[model samples]
Target: MMKVANPPKVSPPANEALTKDARQYGVVIGALAGFCENGSPLVSLGDRPALTAMTLVDVGEQHIGMRVAVQFEGGDLGLPLVIGVVRDNSGVGSSAGASAARVTSECGLSATIDDDEIVLIARRRITLRCGAASVTLDSDGNVEIRGKHLLSRAAGQNRIKGSSVSLN
Candidate 1:
């Protein structure tokens, strides 16, 4: 016997469709890289002279972690995460749950993950493009760094062979 043709798939309800965005990425306004009428204020992200949406030029992600490049449109200058800065991918437009903002490194990594850092990924990488100084990993595998501002590494002197590295 010949089988009957399948009917057209039923469309989701309007409210349901809207919920999809809220569930997956987040609010619709926050998702766009442009002005959002009902989105979080620009001040919430950074204190730029003229806050605006940052364009995602590039993105570096690891598992649950992500770093996106935000191109400032001459409005917000010198603002780190707003444009040339890096922050954890955990709370992109979240009003709360912001652990701390992070910065990117030369080794294609994100550092200074806030205690708010999302541990969803084993080891993640974000980018906050900025020029930073170099440190010598001493003979004993210890590098006593000073005046450094890498939030993550500076917190702990991990894997320092023998010498003491005062990160403070």
Candidate 2:
């Protein structure tokens, strides 16, 4: 009787072989976050390291500054693939579909349509606040306040020009 030993598996050298791939997180930059061209979402770590990522699905047209996670096959930065956008605590940079951008927070949910329509739907009320002015729109739509306070102050001249002027 004789016993035989099998040879060990051979692996390429570490330096000569391609590194195993892993997911890396980065921020989206450039003009339109590289979403306008197509489904390719460009992710950038800084100025030098940037690559066009092939996403699982179209991440839609995102804002200039958005967080994204990408995976590089065989640790090759040149062949990066996009997973999805990394949503922050505020819930911005969320893509509902290939043409929709949504943001949900404690305040409310806001979405930006690809065609340039911004729709804000709130459970309670919606408030727009500025430095010295504010507009409050309630859910019922019965109450609409143009400004926080009533004031007639114009830099040049105050003119009330309308088709019909009625004071109640």
> Which RMSD values do the candidates have, in order?
16.4, 15.5
Put down candidate 1 lDDT per residue, 38-127, tens digits, no spaces: 432132223212233334333222212232333322222322223322344664432223455433322222334466443211123222
Mind giving the per-residue lDDT tens digits that candidate 2 earns over 1-168?
Answer: 765587666443343233432323343322223432344555554333345656664565444346566665445556556666666577877432445544433223333346567676666676667786767777786444565568789899899876797998
Model 1 TM-score, all chains together: 0.18
The segments of candidate 2 whose C-alpha lies over 4 angstroms from its true place after superposition are: 1-32, 36-39, 94-168
lDDT of each: 0.33, 0.51
Best candidate (score: lDDT)? 2
Candidate 2 residue pairs in backbone clash? none
- Which run of 10 residues does model 2 get worst, by summed lDDT? 23-32
Native-vs-model 2 lDDT? 0.51
